[model samples]
Target: MKFLHIADLHIGKRVNEFNMIEDQKYILEQLISVIESEKPKGIIIAGDVYDKSQPSGEAVELFDDFLTKLVSLAEFVFIISGNHDSPERLSFGSRILKKSGLYIAGVFDGKMNKITLKDEYGPLHVYLLPFVKPAVVRAYYDEEIESYNDAVNVIISNEKISMDERNILVAHQFVTSGGVSPERSDSENISLGGLDNVDASLFRNFDYVALGHIHRPQKIGRDEIRYAGSPLKYSFSEARHHKSVTVLEIKEKGNVKIDLIPLLPLRDLREIKGPINELIKIGKEDYKGSTDYIHATITDEDEIYDALGKLRQVYPNIMILDFDNKRSRSNISFEELSSEKIESKSPLDLFEEFYEAQNNKKLSEEEIKIIERLLEKAGGIEI
Candidate 1:
């Protein structure tokens, strides 16, 4: 069986405060082209389908177009809801949608909704697992589970089939050693010690594990488990990633052949740092490829009051700016600030001995009051 794997499309993403509606439309068209050219039997989108829980109409249409395209050539398509998705909204017409070769799981009903597809080599059974937090799982079971680990274990253990089936598991959540992007999680997801991290050992029973939530395509511990990454560069941190979708070909004998199909983005993301003069060398073009989104940092000796204005004349789509100062800034070093000795007699404790030798033991009323105020404001420095 041959299938395509993609995730974190983030269809409603607002890139650099500009509407990416056209860009998203182009990508959805590209995905259709891939499906028609490759003729994959099925496709799997792990999670984070939309940028917002309540997505805009444009985002909904973009998603509809992509799904409508895939169902034309693909025999089966599997999708799960992520933390960013409103499950009820995404899973609209779940019963009817599944009949059109799409299987979606937004609610954890404690049952595996397995979709079976046929190829020359028997059948492939794919199990869809959506994003579920510890609290949600506990509520589903009506029991108190200690952590997400317990909830995950319970969900996996309850599967009523053997591990040896032609099975695939799809999930969306953080796992150890995964890469993240800034475009996702608008300040809420970055809490509680980044505890969303899960271990790779959870999928030991499955034939292959398709994962998501990490925006950079990578293999977790082994090739059998992997993330296809996002379709486009979603944030500043994802500037260095070469976005891709994966194609997996599996045979009846449990032989797997996975191919990385790289997606060339409509506009590249670039970060450039240098002085204004060097940055705008009129004679040459350095960032010719990244004409869409560029973040520039000016390390100038003097402030160019309208640096952004000047840069806009050169690169019209410039999105970010920063001024870096590497000189004329003095502060105590870390060693100096943190090092204080109290094991021996402190200077204040042995004031009389130190005063006799150096003749500088005490401060005047003005100096003493200033020191007292500084200490009080500094939270009364430790010791």
Candidate 2:
């Protein structure tokens, strides 16, 4: 039994802060081509099937077409919803879809519903673990599950899984110190301490563990337990990482072999850092593939006028711009800055505190009122 592993598809994703619909279409086409050529027995989409809870019509259509192609092979397809997905929307008609070899695990109903797929040798049991909040999981199980780690353990322990079966577990969440991409920073709500950590031993009994939530594809601890990253470059930070899916060949129940198939991009991700004159003159240099997607940082004393237009000739997908050289250079430590504890008080009390702290200059009535509203929205009293 062989299968293709892909995740964080984010089908309706409008990345780089730009609505690049055409680029998305091109990448999806490339992915379909891979499926056609590989012809795996099953395909596992780890999580984040769609970019939004209410995805646009085009996104739904694109996903439907993609599934239609996959359905032709009638391969076992397993999916789980991420934080971005609306469980109700994603799981709609999921039961019926399962009849066609498709399974969507959205809501955490406290049952480890295994989609058993029979191969030439024996049965393969795959567990679909969708993104779940600790509160929800605790309520469903009727327990005090304070953290994601706690909730997962409770689920695993209570799940009616057989030790005799060859199991596969799929999950989506931050696995303690797993790789973080800039794209994820925007989409994922960072629940660092309590909600972030999950032990790899949770899936010890499984033959293979397919993971999601992390954008850059990488093996967490080893090759067997891995993340088949997003199909396309979702962030400038992921500029250097090669996006790809993992193809697994399981000849027997417990044995597994893995292969990483590199994905082709409509525009490659790239970053360049230098002075204004140097970046402007990058076209003159022998930069071959840098034109695809560019994140240029100008390290100059002054802002370069129309910097993007100048670089667009050589780099078409230049979406982000930064000025490390020209902008304010403060070397203050984040830890120290964030550690300053302020007291919750009235608007006037807040003004007195900030006024004395910044420059020992007191604020006027009008200034105080304006600053009060701003700080109120920014959680000034919540210090």
For 1-383, candidate 2 gives per-residue lDDT tens digits of 78899998888877667665567788878878888888998888888888899999988888888888777864678889888788889899999998888999988787656888776777778889998778778777776687777888888888777777678888887764343322343344566545566767666777888988878878766567887888887777677778887999887766789999998887777788888677767645745665566788877765557877877766666778776741234332223344234223454564565555443346787887787688778876532
Q: Per-residue lDDT of 95-174 in model 1, one digit per residue for the tens?
A: 89887888898777775578876677776778888888887777667555776666777788777656566788898876
Best by TM-score: 1
Model 1: worst 10 consecutive residues (lDDT sum): 179-188
Cα lDDT of candidate 2 equals 0.76
Worst 10 residues of 2 by lDDT: 326-335
Displacement of the residue 278 alpha carbon in candidate 1, Å:
2.5
The global C-alpha lDDT for each of the candidates, from Candidate 1 onward, is 0.74, 0.76
Q: Which residue pairs show collisions in model 2?
A: none
The runs of at least 3 residues in candidate 2 whose Cα sits more than 4 Å from the true structure, single-residue gaps closed, are 177-188, 284-291, 326-383
- Clashing residue pairs, backbone N/CA/C < 3 A, model 1: none
**Clash count for each candidate, listed in order shown:** 0, 0
